[model samples]
Target: MPLAGLFAGALGAAIAPFALRLRGPYLAIVSLGLVYIGIYAARNLPALTGGLNGTVVTAPVAIGPVDFAALQVGPFLLTREQGMFILCWGILALVLC
Candidate 1:
């Protein structure tokens, strides 16, 4: 996930200059074109995206000793959704800082 974020960041940085230069309708057109291209690629790439069927991406929801999937804090046990909420907010706070 971190690597994917990094790759997306890099791709965004690479495109920013050209994207930033456009204004109004031209920017909207370009953005729409890129979105279509992305959708088409995802639909066609079977090995990478599972084509039209799509793919499931699963990763261990643990950070060292803390397992977000089944988080236990003191006497309180959190449900998966609650644990994920906390984990996501924590990450967002860290990134914002």
Candidate 2:
């Protein structure tokens, strides 16, 4: 899905050469209109995006062979907080990569 968005953005950039012939204010208006449309779509499509309240996300389970449920570090046992920490760091690593 991210790759598809990247491709779509590239296609938009490729088409910008034609749009560049337009006046600066016209281009800005078009861009702002598109942004408004995107925001409207996101708000109206509740079934797809969960509306303004947002959506619930399940935490991931384990890190490689080490089961998160079984992990115990010092006095702290692995629970929801640790699981969330692992999940967040994993996502961060993926984004950085």
lDDT accuracy of residue 85 in candidate 1: 90
Best by TM-score: 1
For all candidates in order, the CA lDDT equals 0.86, 0.76
Maximum-lDDT candidate: 1
Residue-wise C-alpha lDDT for candidate 2, range 17-72, written one tens digit per residue: 97788888998887787678768977999896567886565655667886665567
Window of ten residues with lowest summed lDDT in model 1:
49-58
Error of 1 at 62 (Å): 2.1
Candidate 1 lDDT score at position 26: 95
List model 1 lDDT by residue over 1-97, tens digit each: 8987997799789888999999999999989988898799788887876688745546778899899989988999997778889999999999999
TM-score (C-alpha) between model 2 and the true structure: 0.41
